[model samples]
Target: MSPEPQATLELQRTLVLVLDLCGTFAFAVSGATAAVRRHLDIFGVLVVSFAASTFGGISRDVLIGATPPAAIEDWRYLAVAIAAGVVTFFWSPLVERLRNPVRLLDAVGLAFFAVAGTEKALAFGLSPLMAALMGMLTGIGGGMARDVLLADVPVVLRADLYAVAALVGAGIVVGGHLLGLPVVATAVAGGLACFALRLLALRRGWRLPVAGGAPPPDGDA
Candidate 1:
């Protein structure tokens, strides 16, 4: 490969790594907050944080045949997750005081994870459609795991436009790649789109249509 192409690839990889780590931290904080709300001990809080931060990435890597997933192989991912968990555990009152902090952090994580996953899937030679789906999975899988551990419904299954936001973001990344756009530009655009859509959905009470008349009182199926 030429020097310029090699440099671009390196930059792309750097961007992906940054996105993944940022998403991990955001999700970890959200998970820790949930654990604190549930009155879990420090160890339980760390467990939940690690699960929420790394489950999606691990699942994506496994499906793509990237054995020894980055989360497991990379010490940075674990360190970031544990740091976020400890911070949240020690500062529960401040974290909880933020208006709907969990959802806010989740949106940040969803944006980053969706874009990063799509990029990795595409690099691994997956079809654009499959890459997009994988990206959505990468965005929502951690939240599902976190909720399961907490004995609650997954936010992706019920939250306003949760999975839809991820899909849209992933689609944007794939679309940009197919169009020969710049990788960094596409990633930022996709992440911002996903984050904005999620927040907008939450603010405007947007939701998919419900079955059997209105949605249940608690927004479950």
Candidate 2:
């Protein structure tokens, strides 16, 4: 590879790393915020934060055959998550003052992770469609895990446009790549597409249609 191509590749790698870490931090804050609202203990808050932020990336890495996973190999990821947890624990009142902070913060995490996950998947030689699916999973998986831990239905299943937003974002990245866009441009476009769609859904009450005409009996009749 020539000097110019090598430099471009290095720049792309750096952008991906920065975006991935940003997603981790955003998810951590979102998780900690949820825990605070649930009145969880400090340890619980930290655990939720760490799991919410890292597991998606870890799962993606594992599926892509990235041994040990970045979450396991990278100390910064855990450090950022713990820091976010501590901040949310001490700043609960301020966070609560924000209207629906959990939903908003979760949207941010979802967008970032969607884009980052797609890029990482592509980098690891996955097909574009598979990359998009992985991206959607990465965006929503942590939240699902968090909800399960809280004994609540996952937002992706309950909320309208949740996973849809992720899929749109991943699609944007894949499309941009196919069109030969710069890595930074593709990342920004994809992240913004996801974030904007999610926020719009929240504001406009957009939702996917559910199954109907089904009334199951309780406990075998």
lDDT tens per residue, model 2, 30-147: 8888898899999999999998898888889999999898888989989999998999899988877864866787788889899989988988889999999999988988888788
Model 2 lDDT, full chain set: 0.85
Candidate 2 residue runs with Cα over 4 Å from true position: 1-4, 100-102, 213-221
Angstrom error at residue 4, model 2: 10
lDDT of 2 at 170: 96
lDDT of 1 by residue, 1-221 (tens): 12337777788788889999999999999889889999999999999999999999999999999989999999999999999999999989988887487678779999999999999998888999999999999999888999999999886786579999999999999999888888889999999999999999999999897677787687644
| lDDT of residue 195 for candidate 1 | 99
lDDT of each: 0.91, 0.85
Candidate 2: which pairs clash? none
Model 1 ranges off by over 4 Å: 1-4, 100-102, 219-221
Candidate of highest TM-score: 1
In order of appearance, the predictions have TM-scores of 0.94, 0.89
